[model samples]
Target: MAAQRTIDVRAVGHVAERIYIHDSYVVTFGPDATSTNLWTLSNDGRRLDHLKILRTLEEPGGIAPIVDTERKLVAITGRSSGPPELHISDISSGDLVRTLMLYGSLDDVRMPYSSRLGHALVSTRVVDELPRVLVVDVAGNGWIAGVAYIPPDLRTSTDDRPDPQFGAEHITDDGDIICSYVAPPLPDGVDHFTLIRWNGTPNENTLPAVRADLSISLVDGDAVSVSCCLPFCDDALLVSACEAVQDAIDTAYSRWSVLRAIGLRALDTLWTAEPVWGVIRRLHHAVDAGVVLATGTQNAREDGGKNIPVSFIAAFDDKTGALRRLERVNHIAQGVSVRLCAATSDTVIVIFANGDMSMASLDDFLAHGLARDVDTHKVATTQLWKDDGKKVVHAALASTSVIVATQTNLVVASW
Candidate 1:
């Protein structure tokens, strides 16, 4: 471990988007009280040599910044009084390259790491209008390639839609967009999940799409709610769902029958308790390691909602999904959200919203599980930074270093 380092971008607001880390520069988006700006800093978290104050009409924190190092391009989503707009700029010069006026109320946008192909998946919904996914080219040409209209019946009326509600999950190397769509609750029917593959082509009507239903029945006539679904690999999907009456978080592989389903609360007695079963907030797969990591607030109400403890669990298993090790990383305060959990070849890094971070050896977890709970700290160490009202909004892992973006500054920590 090394001494934590920080860089100050004075008066810059909290990071509301993803931070982009390239060879030697860290690019981020944020705003002050009056306007938004695109910032670039050295990779060591020491200097802010490049800054571009955006237009006065641009909305702050509207879209996460996406950088394409291969093309020296940066894409940002913002809005004025009209629909959302996508801005493309030169990463080195911070000069505006192009602006594409996306004509709907934007919900979300996903950009591929490399923009050499000039494509992005955009989701938007207007009042009394159908939600749609738009495939746009954010290069200087600004071409609208295709649109996928979300089935009207799939829109949930219960509350704010769970994410991936008609959003792109993954884009293949061959220009195919893999996305997820969840049908809303029906009169007497259970909600279903659909995984669609769209060929990136211009279409006046619905985009040429092929879809597969990923829903499964554990028992007859049981209603299940899909919490989230993401592309697991080139041919498989990872889905999380909860039965109508079951509180445990059930995670399964969409295409692999050999991989058995695992519950987040299955191995821990603390999580098996009544209310804690519903506490699993998010699930992420370490694709390189064939393991799953889940994070959430446990026993939230028991702590009177002020300082609840958030828990992290790493589940390691084989290709057949037999549980090998279920390790619960020590819980942290409720105010601290796990902003990001990323892994390298051998280390797993977890970043917290309150500026706390920890790293655990992936090899150790696979070898020991929780066999030596007391020695867990030896393999994993937690460090806390002084709270300054600036929360860490996003993080990225570059080799062994972790790049973190807070509301006012950028930090780089080495494991």
Candidate 2:
């Protein structure tokens, strides 16, 4: 582990809300609290470069930004008051290449695994409407290549009652869009949750009927539901339920089966087991590091006038789903959450809501979980700012460094 070097970005004036680290450049989004701008910072954090600034429209999602390095293109969602717009920019020159206006509000945007395809998966929903998934070609004049609509019957009602919403899971490397919807039980005793895949074709502007690709069933009555069904590697679908993480596989042609299911444990102060209340926030696959999972849980017990919620980052073997490395941090204050976790070549970088950043060595963590001894598994810890008022919203990691973004500034620390 290298000695910690901190670069305080609060002096930069603009609020840096999102951070992305590509090959040699670090990209950040948001200027002040009200303005939407993108800036590129050097890896060492010594230099700040202005990339692009949006003066006309508000980026309601802080650009929900996605960057394709090979295509040199970046896409971000604009404000949602009127007809929504998606902005595409050139990463190299920071020029606004094009803007895509849609009939609905853009909820999510994702680039395919292969940059050669030059298309992105977008999820949008009109006012009081169900969600629709569209395939957009960024290189081909930003045309709508294909579209898929969620079934009306399965869509959540717009009423005030608590309803299950729809979300896009993942876009496969081959450009297929995987979507999942959670539905509450009807008058009868059955729920209508489904997982669907929208096959991508070259056809343009055609809305294809939604097809349910996989049928999921809750194993126990206590198992509330399943969500975040995403494609894992090249074969399996990684899914998270209220209490478990499952790997769904295709045993036969188009026949899916749960190969392995692992139950999650709630964070307990004492050694006694508690009811599971944690939810899996995100899952990611690293180069040679297998699968990395992030989970969040609110502590139910009141301890010393504080209810401490915690975030856990664990690594599992890709094939066996066995635990490799685990680390958990307690958030002592409210509104403090884990913004992002990135797995680099040998280190796991975690950025929290209070602007505290930490790194753990992969080898050391696998051998000794969360060792407190600074000489063993821990790398370096740095406090970017004193005020927890400005939250750390996003983070990304390169092979050698990590960049974190707060509502007011961007911090770059080298490992």
Candidate 3:
């Protein structure tokens, strides 16, 4: 294998709300959410060339542009002269393909890579009416395939409590809508949040039936925290579940957390792994790479409440959970959190909160005996870039390169 090469590209004045990357190109959303610029990598993979300016929406609505790299399309929200609308355009030609007027102000939009062409789930809110989620088909002439209003039970609150709010909502490729709703605390004393999945496509004037209520459906009946749940591969959800326990030694309450992969459609546990670190936090589900990468942290209890941060890069076989390994990441300072992680098939790139970057090999494993005997082994890694608090805005991993972007610069490291 060739030695890895790191290159720094000056991206002054190229700030963006978000960045999306493919193996061949990179797309940056305008910081003001008005336009998007598509950039193609140079032949030597060291520089980025301006491909074309993709003007998505006609009017600014402060809606962030969603780039679907798999479909080579960009979706944006606007309200020029009529109702709030969504615009779909091609990334290559920058040609407007379809425009659909929405029911009200667009609150959020989610597009699944495997969804039908020009299809997405959009949430909108009206002045006096409750929020509604609409299934939009932007092909040819725009049309609304279905609509689902917020349930009356979830729209109101008790006299003493505040109104329940919706958290993260996802629309799967099969038209399954998964929403997280958090309600006021009940007498049970546990967090009253539920992960609801509506299976099947919603038809005109009819909402799909709810298939699973994940809050009370698990074997242990522990509420799955939506903030720690990650949607994976359009069909699976990576969940980090924590259950309080009474420590026998200290006679105090402690928490035990485990990571599991749950199939959204079948409503089954695909696989589970217990990390030595008790807390599972940041997660990356790289389906294309066939591995799930996550970071686990635990504080030291013996050191007078001082934190001994134990951060590990765990790799798991996505399908069968055949290969499970916990490797400690070297050189990360104490109390510095991992802000972003991007993984390809063979490489994993991590950026710390302090603007330091490191790359590790996912394919290279420690010897079987050594890994089994030791509680944690370090993955061989290379320090690609470091800064003293410049702050990484976003990062994306492609087949041949990893791109890290800060407010003032873009760095490309390729092998």
Candidate 4:
């Protein structure tokens, strides 16, 4: 194996919003942050610099910066305090010039994601109008969801044609809002997914806004995947999930004493949809070289608070539903364990509370080596994320000053 490279974090402050891949170093900025602070560094853990993301009113870190090579634009996937938002930067001048946002006021919230093609997609929870249905948009500002108001005088038929055939006021300049993509909302509560798209002109060779087709018809309940993200964008949209279903504890008893994981998978209806299940919690970063997933599973579980079991670690292939690797963590603090996916490789790094970040190749886990543990403790502050009944978790890569922001001081990262 190659010698372990060192990534000097030059700086770590308030909170991070997004990390933008720049020509020199990866530029990180904050969304709800106060000042426009940007952290810059090279991709190979070499050169680094820090600059002002925008002028003033730095929105902190609520967006991710993507390099639009074709458009020569440094596009930012940003969010705001009130409704969700998406901002694009004028790479020519390093300024946030364009914008996008969710239109309707759904009971819950919506999250923005992107395809490999640079086209962004967002999903939100819908209430009043429909239950168990998600509102969606692909073209962003070029779309809208509304009903054309028809006057009584225009009705000539006896029953006054109920809804207009072309009633759906859609595909404006905002974006294309597509419905009926996923199977349907689960019955009880088990995370399910769907796919939708916009044809630019509804009929043209523009581009296929293909979405991940997640179906939940078989599972008659509500279930969601939160805080987990796909490693990268392959032909198929593959995602990884980590649910520490139990809390950590320290006990003293010796009957040939050995602690184990006690995970409790819950099944509820009401609370399921309220929190929006199966949402991606975070995206540490994408790795293009690997197509596998690594996991650290807990044996013991939780009922109220989230759980973490320092017991086991495993790996799997996203293309084929096959277990690639698995290992048991020598119980450190009883029921507490976690695996952090590396940003460049398919390496699932382990972090313990004792503050040691170690890495083990998932490739070796498939051959023979046990889930080599990396004892690492995240240096971050715990903060409460206020989500609007939407089964959504913000993957905002909070940073100091790489791009301009609308607000600042987003929730601090716990891990």
Superposed on all Cα atoms, the candidates' RMSDs to the truth, in angstroms, are 8.1, 8.8, 6.5, 12.8
What local distance difference test score does each model get?
A: 0.52, 0.54, 0.57, 0.33
From the highest lDDT down, the ranking of the candidates is: 3, 2, 1, 4
Best by lDDT: 3
List residue ranges in candidate 4 displaced over 4 A: 1-32, 55-72, 75-84, 105-118, 125-234, 239-291, 294-299, 302-306, 309-313, 327-343, 351-355, 368-415
User: How well is each residue in 287-325 modelled by candidate 1, as lDDT tens digits?
Assistant: 677765444433333422444343445453424444555
How much is 84 displaced in model 1, in angstroms? 0.9
Kindly list the per-residue Cα lDDT of model 4 for residues 286-384, writing each as its tens digit. 245333433323333334334334434444443333445445454444233332323224444444332233444445445654433256432221112
- Which pairs clash in the backbone of model 2? 15-31
Top candidate on TM-score is: 2
Candidate 3 per-residue lDDT, tens place, 1-415, comes to 2344454543444666466675567877665667667888765556677788876555645444556666777666677777888778887798877777786666533333223544566667666554566767754365876666555555553455533444335667566766555554443334334555666555434443553443332333333344356677756888665443222221112334556677886656777665333456656666666777766545434434544444556767778654466655433333356555555666666666555555655654312211221323433234444456576677666665766666766666666
State candidate 4's TM-score.
0.50
TM-score ranking from best candidate downward: 2, 1, 3, 4
Ranked by TM-score, the better of candidates 1 and 3 is: 1
Which 10-residue window in model 3 sums to the lowest lDDT?
366-375
Clashing residue pairs, backbone N/CA/C < 3 A, model 1: 14-407, 154-184
Off by over 4 Å in 1: 1-25, 31-57, 61-63, 109-116, 151-164, 186-189, 202-209, 216-309, 313-318, 321-325, 329-340, 352-355, 369-396, 405-408
